[model samples]
Target chain A: MRVPILSLGEVLVASIQDALTDRGWRQLQADLLAQAGRRPPPGSRRKTAPRGVVIDLSTMDVMDSYATRSLDGIARMLALRGAETVVVGIQPGVAFAMAQLGLGLASAGTAVDLEAGLALLAEQVRGDGRHHGA
Target chain B: MAVTMAPESRLPVRDDGEIVGARRAARALAATLGFSETDLTMIATAVSEIARNMVEYGGGGEMTFAVIDGDGRVPGRRGLRITATDHGPGIPDVERAMQDGYTTGRGLGLGLPGARRLMDEFRVESAVGVGTTVSMTKWVV
Candidate 1:
C-alpha cells in the first residue's frame, strides 16, 4: 500500500479566514474534488477504496471553533467517499481544547504527531486494510 | 488611558447557524488581548455553544464581553471576560443544565457545560421566568 505524506505546518484559522472569504473555502473544496478525480500515483496498490488523506496541523498558529467545525465537516465528507483521514501535528493543548469544544475527532480516527501519525498509518495499511477500507 | 468596558456589545445572541461569525468574533477579541491561538479557539467555541443555547432554549439573549487584566485582581491568569444574559425563561435546575449529555431538545446538550469546560472561570445565574446569565473567563497568559 502506497501512502502519501501530508506535512502540516502552522495554520492559523483566523488568518486563513481573513485571507480568504467564503469564496476561498469554496475554491478549496472544488480544488480537492478536481484533484481526487485525477489518476492514482504510479505503482499504487488498488484497494476496494482509495487510500485515506493525511492532514498536517502542526503549524497552526490559531485554530478557532469555526475552523474546527469546518474541518470536521470536511473530514466527514471525505469519509463518505471511503477515504480515511489522518490529522497529525495537533498540539496536545489544542487537542484538549478541541475536545473541550466537542469536536470529537479523537473518536473518528487516530491522531498523533508527525512521526507517530505516519507510523500508525503505515501500520494500519499493513495490518487490516479494513480499518478505513471501504 | 481609561479603558472602557461594555458588556452590551457582546449581547444579542443569534442561532442562525452562523458559526463563522461566532468564531470570527472570538478570534478578533482574543487577538486584541494577545491571547494564544489555543485560547482563542477555546473562547470562540464557548461563545458559539453559549450563543446557540441562548437561541435554542432561552429564545435568545444578550451577550457582553469585558477586558480583564491580571494585576493580581480577579482570580486566575489575565484574560478577557465573556457574559451571556437572557431574559427568557430561566433554567429550572442549573445543575442538570451543567451536566454533560443533558439536553431538552435534539442538541447534544454540550452547550453550557462545554463552554464552562473551556474557560478557567465560569458562572451561571438563572431564575424561573426571569432569565439566565453565563459568565466565562479565559486566561490570556
Candidate 2:
C-alpha cells in the first residue's frame, strides 16, 4: 500500500504507518521525489521548490537493515534533488533495535516528534534563506 | 545436551512482503511468551533481517518458530527459538559475512551480525553449494 504524503507549505510529510515492503518503499521514494519536483499547491505563494521532506515513523515498530538502508538512500536521493529530509517519531523500541543492529540513518535530520520535525525543517529552510509559506 | 522441541510453525520467506509477515508472526509468538515491548521489537527486527536475507541472498527459504522450556538448572524459564533455512547458494565465507559492514547485496551489511546481536543465542551453519540455516533465540527474563 502507498503511504500518505502530505504537503505543508514548503515541506512534504510522509507518515509511514506500517511496515512497508521493498516495493512499497521504492514507491515511497519515487513518490517523494515526484512530489518534491511538483509545484506548490494552488493558493500558496511559496516557492515552487520543495525545501524539505519529513518522514514520520511513529507507528513503525520494526526497522530492519533493509528499511534503514532504504531510508538512508531516500534521504540522500532527496538531498541530491535539493530537498532536505528529516526522519521523525522513531519509537524507543525501534531506536534500541536499530542501535543494537548497528544501523544508522546518518544522512537525514531526525526529530522525536512531528512538531519537532516540522520545526527542524522550517529552521533548515529559513537558515538557507528560503521562504516557507505561512 | 538433549532439549525437547515444542510445537513449531514454519513460514515461507519468498519476498519482502513475506519478511514482514514473518516479523509479525514472530512478534505475536514472542508476545504470547510474555516478552516485553522492547524485546518484542528486537525479536521482530531479528526475524526481519534473517527472513530478508533468506529471500534476497538465499533465494527464498523457510522460517520456523518454537518455544523452548528450560529444564533442571533453570526451571520455569521459557524462550523463543527462530530458525531460518534456505536451499539456495550458501555463504562462501561465514566469518566475513558475520562481520559488521559486510554485505553482498545492496544492503548496509548489518543483517547477519545485527540479528546476532539482537538475540540471546545465535548459530549459523552454511555450505557453499548447499544451503544456509540460521537459528536464534530470545529468552524471557
Candidate 3:
C-alpha cells in the first residue's frame, strides 16, 4: 500500500496501517525524503522546511529486521536533509518482539504517540542544547 | 490429558503477500493455543523474517505452522513449531548466515539471528545450490 505522508504543520506524519511490501517501504522512503527536502514557498502558513518526521507503527504488529533497519535508514537520511525523524506508536507486543529479536532503531528518536512526537520535534529545535545535536 | 486435536497449517510463501499470510497464520494458530499477545507478536515477527528471506534469497518457499508435542525428549510439552523451506540457492556458509550482521549486501543481516533469538529452538539445514530449511519452535510458557 502507498503509505501517505501527511504534513502536520512542520512535521510530516506517516502512519503505517498495513503490511508494507518491499516496494511500499521503498516508495515511502522516497516520498518522505522528497517531502522532507521541500520547503513551503513563501506566503505559506509559517515557513522553513519540515522540521520533523513521525512514523507511527501502532498498526504494525510485526517489525522484522527489515522494517527496523529501513526505518533507521530513513531517519539518518532525513537528518542529512536537515529533518529529524521520530518514530511513534510502537505497539507493546511489537516492542517486546523487537527487543527479543535484538532489533532496534539506533538513531531515530522515538515517542509514545503523535502528540509526543510533535512535542519532541519542537523541543529539538528549541535551541536549548538538548536537541541531541540534530 | 493432552490435546490431541493439534492443528497445523501450510502456507506457500511465494511473494511478499504470502509472507504476510504466513505471519497471520502463525499468530492465529498461536492464539488458539493461548499464547500471550507478546508471544503472538514474536512468532509473527519471526515468521516474517524467515518468510521474507525465503522470498528474497530462496526465490520463494513454504511455511508450516503446527502445534507440536515434544518428541520423546520432553513428552506432552506442546507448543508452536514453524518450519520454512525453500528450494533456491542455499547458503554456502550456514554458520555465517546465522551470525548477526552477516548479509549478502542487501539487508542488515539480522533476519536469521533475530528470528532465532525470538524462538526457543532454531535449526538451519542448507546445502549450496540444494535448498535450505529452517525449523524453529517456541514452547508455551
Candidate 3 local distance difference test against the native:
0.87
True C-alpha contacts between chains kept, each model in order: 0.32, 0.89, 0.87
The sequence of per-residue lDDT tens digits that candidate 1 reaches over residues B65-101 is: 7776553654534567888888888999999999987
Model 3: residue A103 alpha-carbon error in angstroms: 2.1
* Top candidate when judged by TM-score against the true structure: 2
Provide C-alpha RMSD values for all models, in order: 7.3, 2.8, 2.5
Clash counts for the predictions, in order:
10, 0, 0
> What 10-residue stretch in candidate 1 chain A is worst by lDDT?
A8-17
Q: Write the per-residue lDDT of candidate 1 for residues A1-134, one digit (tens) a residue.
A: 11222222211011121322233444554544444334555675532334455556775533434445555665676556544456667776667777765666632355566566656656655564556433
Error of 2 at B49 (Å): 0.8
Across residues A67-127, which tens digit of lDDT does each residue of candidate 3 receive?
8888899999999999888999998999998888787798799999888988998888675
Clashing pairs in 3: none
Q: What is the lDDT of residue B15 in candidate 2?
A: 90
lDDT of 2 at B35: 93
- Per-model B-chain TM-score: 0.85, 0.95, 0.92
